[model samples]
Each structure stands twice: as C-alpha cells, then as structure tokens.
Target: MIKIDAMMVCLDLSDIDEKLVAFSRTICERMQVGKVYFVHNIKLYELGDDFREMFGDVDLAQEVEGNINDIVDEQFANKTAYEVLVSEEPNTEVILADLVKRYNIKLTLLGKKMSTKSTGSLGTKLLRILPCSVLVFPETASFNIQKVLVPIDFSDTSVHALRLSKNLSDQLGLQLEIMHVYRLPSQFFPLISEEKAVRKAEEVVKGKFADLQKRHNEIAGIPYTLVRAANKSIAERISLHLEKGRHDLLVLGLKGNNPLPSLSLGSVPTEMYNTDINVPLWLVYSEEVIK
Candidate 1:
C-alpha cells in the first residue's frame, strides 16, 4: 500500500487555494494522513520595480504565509498537524523537491487551472522531478469522491495502482472500477471487418484480465471494463469513459515498465495532465520500482 502519512499541498495565492485547502482536509480525514504542509512560492524578483516601495517595509513572505495560515487554520489545520511554507526562491521545483525530501512526504497535492490550453506549469515539472506520487485537482473538481476510476494497461505498475485504488475504495465506502483501453491492430484492419476486430479485441482483453486475476488475487472481485479505442486516443477514450461514468477521480501509474531507473510520466498521463481533463488525477509513482 502507498503510505500517505505525510502530504504536502502546493498552493498559489489564487482562487484555487481555497478549494485546495478545503480538499486537503478531506484527504487527511479519509486517508488518515498525519501531517499536511501548505507550500507556496513567492518570486520576489519577478515583482515590479516599485513593489517594495508600494508596500513599504512589509514582509511579503510573512504576509503570504499569514494568508495561507488563515485559510488553512479555518478549513484544515485543526484536524491534522499542519505548517505553512512560503518561499521566495525563483526555482519552485527545486524548493519543493527539497521540502518533500526533508519532510519524507509520500504524496503531493497540487491545484491546476483548467481554463488555459498550455501545461508547462510547475505541477507538470514536479511530477518528473519529485520522487513521491502526485494528486492534481482541477479548479472545478468536487470535494467528494463518489466513484473512482483506474485506467490500466495490465502492467505491474498499473496493477499496483489498481490495488491502491481498491484499498482506498474499500476504506471510503465508494464504488471502484477499472478500465482498459484496447486498440485493434492495423495489420488486421483490411482483412477483418470492424465488428470482428472489436470482438477479437474484447476477447483478448478478457483473457488478459483473467490472467491478471490469477497473478494478482487482490483484484479478482473488483469490477473492470474494456474500452476499445476506435478513432480516439487512449487518453481520449479514458476521458470519455470518465465523463460517461461520472467518475470524479482518475488513478494511473506513472509509466509502464521502464528499464531506466528514473522517473518518467507515460504518454497517456502526460497528455491528460497537459489537456483539460476536468477532474482530479492521481499519478502513482513507485520509486522502488525504478530504484
């Protein structure tokens, strides 16, 4: 099981901070997290030339920390051991990586803005830099988890993610389901009709699932679905399934069996992170697997 004893929440002094703080409390209560760290980065150098003159003798770091404390104390601090970390460092990824290591953080929560079309944000970088797992909450994400979905490719890493999802689902009394997106090989496209191709894909997936159950007994009784990607990408198919099933949370493994002993986010997850998926995504990274 993934140990969520300590989690750090990245906050920017924006509208999403409120939702991030509120959701942090929910995660602490549900996952039995012992400590919560509210972290923010204030790039003082990037401020306007007259920033200090305008705010004369004001400690910007203190002020920012105070603001975060007010929200965290009001919405979150009472339930768990909490601290506010406000940094003036220009490199956010570096500071966050240090904090995670110093605090032995197992999970990191970040808020993503879903309005834009770009994804070169700090959250995306942190996924590749930090050794711990990450959970991202879109601005419009709800504070509840009624249904959870885990998209797997039947790799050991994905199966491990499924096990974690199963444990969480059982603990929270929520419905849990797994989905696998399959694609018909192009070699058989001309020889076989679309119907036959789909049937063959389903049959292959069923057999694979049966083999997976035999290998991993913990996933035997959980419900699973096989989605065939006809004209859509794997990420698109998963997003469609999430919307159709009303699943508020998505859990995925970082990558399928990578030979290099380093962290790398897979294409599907990287795509989901970059696009406007409009849901909270949990990317489970097993440092031990790569190490």
Candidate 2:
C-alpha cells in the first residue's frame, strides 16, 4: 500500500465547479492519504478600479475553515476518516510547501479550477521545487488508467517513470506505449549542410531506446510501442506525434537545467498541457521518483 503522510489541498472558487471538499474526502479514501491540509487562498483585488470593493466583515479565513468542516461533517460524517488541517497562506506554492515540510509530506493531490485559462500547470511549477510526488487532477480524470504513454529519453528518470507506470498498469490492466521522438536536423535547419546529421540522430535514438525497451520486457514486464518522429520543434513535434498515436495518459521523465519556471508553463510539457492533448501528462524527475 502507498503511504501518504501529508497532502496539501488547494480550493479556489474561481476555477472549481464542483464541491471540492467532497472530492477531497473521496480522494483521501481512494489514495489512502492520512492527513490533508485544506487551504483556501483569497487573492487581493488587483484590478485598477474595476473591482476593488472591500468585503464587509467577511472573514475568508473563518469561511475557509467552516467549508472544510462542512466537507468533513456532510460528506464523511460517519467515516471517521483522516485529519484536515487549516492554514491561511494565500500563495499556492508557499502554502503547499510549508505544509509539505511541516508534516513531512510524501504525496500531494491537487485540483484545477476551470477558469478561462489555467495558471499554466500548478503541478509542473510545484514539482520543480517540491520534494514529493504530486498527483495533478485534470478537468476529468478517472480512477481507472486504461492506456498509458511513456516518452523515453533513456535516462534513469524515464525508467523510474516506467517502474511506476508498470505498477499502475498491472493494477488497472493498462496497455503502455513507449514513445521516442527522433529529432532530425534536416527537418529543423534546411540551410545547414551537415548531410549526415539526420542519419546520425536516427542511429542515436534507436541505440538509446531500443535497449531500454528490451530491458522493460526482461525486468519490469511491460509491452510498449516505439514511436519515432523526424521533426525539429520538440514541443510542437511531440504534439503532432501524439495526435497520430492515440494515447490516454502521457508519462515523461524531466531532465536537465535547474528547471526554469518556464520549463513546464513555457516549454514542451506546457505547450502540450495548455493545448488540447486529449489526456493527462505524468512527469517524474530522477531525484523525485525511485528507479
């Protein structure tokens, strides 16, 4: 059984449509998370005279506590479930990180509000800094993971993702597909005269991932498809390739860089997440996920 010692839960009315408290309770039961810190952040008025009316004696702190209790009492009154702590931190990362360290959090479960545009990926941003595994809830994510996509870069982190993916696939009887996008410089730089670049790149991708695929069969016990693409723009090329191959879930191992804040919200993962990818993306870093 996976253990969840502490979990940071964020609820914002701006993007949330359903009763977040109810879902929180259900999540606790399903994932077996023991303790959760229910956090409701109220951003200060930021419009220039468009919306600066002060709320009359309306203490958002007290309201957030009441809502949390209501969730416990109304949803799981007889369940005698886990504990929910209350905090008043308004920043998403600050609140979540404080609780994570205070309670020695192992996993975090988060939900997104259906605003016109999301604050990019809160999980991606938090994952860069946080030391725990985070479960990012999409608009509609089901308990059953039927199909899984694992994008390989032949890193230890990629194998770690496969390790987790293999366990999940076993639990849900999922079909996992291995995708390796082979970038061709010919497709990228038409003017450059490195005629052998494309061929060398192809050889490299095949050499890297081909062995990893065989290792999966020999060890973790997973069957997957190897996808190759000759494109320049890694992010856009990935999106197009995903369109060609129908997948329900995307698994990736993030590597390199100190992690620019723009890594997720501005780079490949962000491009895929912001756009209509028709699936959920699961990213794991080598240090975060054990191989």
CA lDDT of each prediction against the hidden true structure: 0.85, 0.58
Pairs in steric clash, model 2 = 15-113, 15-114
Where does model 1 exceed 4 Å of error?
A: 1-3, 117-120, 256-263
In angstroms, the error of model 1 at 154 is: 0.8
> Going through the candidates in order, what is the number of backbone clashes in each?
0, 2
Model 1 CA lDDT for position 31:
71
What's the TM for model 1? 0.93
Error of 1 at 50 (Å): 2.0
Q: What's model 2's TM-score?
A: 0.71
Q: List the residue pairs that clash in candidate 1.
A: none
The sequence of per-residue lDDT tens digits that candidate 2 reaches over residues 1-291 is: 344566655555433414445555655655556676655555444323433455555665676667666665775543424555555544667766766777777655556533465665565567666655555556655444467877666667667777777766665567876666665545556566555765677677767666765776633345444344543555565666666776667766655344454452225554554554545566554444421
